[model samples]
Target: MMKPLPLDKVYRFIEPGPVVLVTTAQGKERPNVMAMSYHMVVDDGDPPLIACMLGPWDYSYRAFRATGECVIAVPTVDLAAKVVAIGNCSGADTDKFETFGLTPLPAKMVKAPLIGECLANFECRIKDDRPVENYNMFILEVVAAWVDPERKERRVIHHRGNGTFVVDGRVLDIRKKMTKWPTYIRD
Candidate 1:
């Protein structure tokens, strides 16, 4: 027999995956980076898309909502402290790039800049905003993606709310036991 669990806070147990730094900006406006965990892949095929959730109260939420352009920077565990610091303050009051001394590289397809130190960077454009009004979610289409060629394998951080964090560890290879899927190619 099993006991009932609280549905409202299920994410605490699910460990909603890794935390990514979402950078957003508009022309003539200062850039913003919010440490975000509410993100997921929507489609893995051509013109891939992702979804990220940002509460209306977040200072960068308005910037993202208005410009619909942002960079999803996947930082490795090496940047855990910087990620925590960025998440602690508001971009509206602080220039996170200057405070953190993070290198901002020009993105290929968006106005927002990408974090040069991150493992991978995805330049995205908002495809839909209907959820921001309902569930505070934004569906984004990835316009450009970059990964550090020198790094063999980068470990990322995962947040479980509160002050708890998880670092990506070990390799789990179950592909041989599962159905072989077609190779995923990126254009």
Candidate 2:
């Protein structure tokens, strides 16, 4: 039997992608990081494009608007607690990198630094911001990406809305069943 759920809680059911830390900076001012999950791949080709939602209310939005660049860092399940806490605070008052003890590493293509503790980091520049007025969404083009090859833990956490979260589990190899886009499968 299906139970009725409130329409307002629908986001918890349809939330997409893993929770990521977005880093942005304006000129020589200190960089800021924001915990975000409202991002998705717009294209997976060479120089991939990503779409993320960031409204003016977010402190990082001003930096994004000023520099038009950011770094999306993917954290593993182990950093779940810190990730949630980072979102609870405001970058306007706190230096998230220092407060959270997250290491910031320089990137080759962007001014925004990458989180050393994250599993992967993608340096991106805004490709389109036409949707910002209505959706607060920006389409970004990835100029560079980095990953920790030595780190063992790889499970990523997904936000189920509110304070709840789900960690990645298990592995299923169904690549052989893929009829189309077989090239996407990796060995």
Would you estimate the TM-scores of all the predictions?
0.92, 0.96
- Tell me how far the alpha carbon of residue 178 in candidate 1 is from the true structure, in angstroms, after superposition: 2.6
lDDT of 1 by residue, 3-55 (tens): 89888768877756688999989668789899999888999877999988988
List candidate 1 stretches off by more than 4 Å. 184-187
Runs off by more than 4 Å, candidate 2: none
List model 2 lDDT by residue over 1-187, tens digit each: 9999999999999898699999998888888999999988989999899999988888999988989899999999999999999888889999999999999999989999999999999999999999989999999999999999998989999999988898998889788888797778955
What's the CA error at residue 163 for candidate 1, in Å? 2.0
Task: List pairs with backbone clashes in candidate 2.
Answer: none
Clashes of 2: 0
